[model samples]
Target chain A: MRVLGVDPGLTRCGVGVVEGVAGRPLTMVGVGVVRTPADAELGQRLVAIERGIEAWLDEHRPEFVAVERVFSQHNVRTVMGTAQASAVAMLCAARRGIPVALHTPSEVKAAVTGSGRADKAQVGAMVTRLLRLAEPPKPADAADALALAICHIWRAPAQNRLQQAVAQHALKGPIR
Target chain B: MRVLGVDPGLTRCGVGVVEGVAGRPLTMVGVGVVRTPADAELGQRLVAIERGIEAWLDEHRPEFVAVERVFSQHNVRTVMGTAQASAVAMLCAARRGIPVALHTPSEVKAAVTGSGRADKAQVGAMVTRLLRLAEPPKPADAADALALAICHIWRAPAQNRLQQAVAQHALKGPIR
Candidate 1:
């Protein structure tokens, strides 16, 4: 399966596309960042990010999209921008009928480096080695996005099974 | 001018439309909420919000969209969802080239009730009085949205003049 992972931000949104499934080698299709000027209006910045993600979706045609699930940050403004950009990415995927998965930062790190507490450099090295790249993707955000794609590709099957089980249990109605 | 105000939320997004310019009486064009169940997936909920806002914009054809700017809340999850929903509202307006404005919660309250610290009941009471409603809009969110629209209609002219002045000053190329 092909997945496009988004590391969402207002000023710089990182995008990476990977092709693979679990128990197989993953290939990097593309990686880049979409940037909007800091001076731009919030709405304009969001529009730019939306257009960028739409262009990537059109070009890559990934079957699934993975976005970083935003948690709290010390800086409220930063967290707000990240959350906004994340929503734009999900909206683009939903508009294109692509399934979207959200991976937490620790989840991505754990999947890529076998340690939830792995540092950025460790995750970056793992991504480079796993994807067999000549060098690690620059600007941290790019490497983070690749990690998210890898994480989603590895976790989706099991997650899908869990979702199915929940659905089945719901259909069976509450314990009476 | 006509304005559509959006009080964004994941579970229940409030929408209100009003028609008028500064120094003139405003008319209530419409008021409602777009609800998505809490049990729905996040992406699905966002998509539902996008669709709801799009439908409102298409039907009302508002000249401007006023969204409540998200602020940091004690509850991180609540703030994140509000930010996401706000982005969706702004995107709908930006897509259609309708001017978008953001009003703070305090600004909305102050505009309608003459105090930034006014409580919800005070704002609701003022909204009812201003709109000549027999009773305040239900669910508080709807009233808050109307207050936002009213605030924008009142504030937009001065804000535009200020923006124009800044642009003009910048064009003159920094004073020697």
Candidate 2:
């Protein structure tokens, strides 16, 4: 399966596409950053991010979209912007009928590095090795996006099976 | 000016429209809430909000759109949802080329009750009085939205003139 991962942010959003399945080597299809000027209006910035995500979707056509979930930050203002950017990514995927998954920072780190507390340097190194790249993707955010894509590709199969099983059980009829 | 005010929320988003100018009697144009099931997926909830806001924009065609600026709250999850909803509102307005403004809770309270520290009841009572309504709008969220509309109508003029002055000054060459 192909996955498009988004590391959502107000000033710099990262987009990465990975093509692979569990227990297989992944190939990097595309990677880039969508940057918006901090001085621009909030609405304008959001529109820019939305357009960027839409363009990526059109180009990559990934089977699944993974977004970094917004978690608490000491700086509330920054967190708010991150959350807004995350929402814009989700909206763009929903508009195109693409399934979206949210992965927490720790979840992504653990999936890539086998440690939920892995630092940026460790995650970067692991991502490079996993994708067999010449070097780690620049700006860290881009690498993070690739990491999310890898995490989803590895995790989603089990999740989908569980959901299917639940649905099938429900279809059998309600319990008395 | 006619203003569309949005009280952003994940489960129940309050929307209201009011028409009037500064120092003039205001009239209520519309008021309603857009609710999504609590168990709905995050992306689905956001799409519901987007559709609701789009419908409001198309139907009312208000001159201005006012959204509640999310502030820090104890509940991080709740705050994130609010921020997401707020973004969707802004996105809908920006897509339509409609001017949008964000008003803080304190600003709305101050505009309606002459006190930034005014309680919800005070703001609601004042909204009813200013709009010349027979009773306060039900579900405090609706009243808060109307207050935001009234606040923007009263505040935007001065803000717009200030922005225009800055732009004009910039065009006349840089100040020494």
Report the lDDT tens digits of candidate 2 across residue range A20-73. Answer: 878989999999899988876677678778888988999999878999988866
* CA lDDT of each prediction against the hidden true structure: 0.88, 0.88
Model 1 chain A: lowest-lDDT 10 consecutive positions:
A167-176
Q: lDDT score, residue A160, model 1?
A: 49
If you superpose only chain B onto the true chain B, what TM-score does each candidate give?
A: 0.89, 0.89
Candidate 1 stretches greater than 4 Å from native: A156-158, A161-176, B159-176
Which ranges of candidate 2 are over 4 A from the true structure?
A160-176, B156-158, B161-176
Task: Give the native contact fraction of candidate 1.
Answer: 0.61
| lDDT (10s digit) by residue, model 2, range B1-176 | 89999999989899999998898899999998988889988898899999999999999998778999998665776889999999999888765556678888888998899999999899989999999999999798899889999999898587855543443343343212
Model 1 chain A, TM-score vs. native: 0.89
lDDT of 2: 0.88
Q: Against the true structure, what is each candidate's TM-score? A: 0.90, 0.91
Candidate 2 vs. true structure, TM-score = 0.91
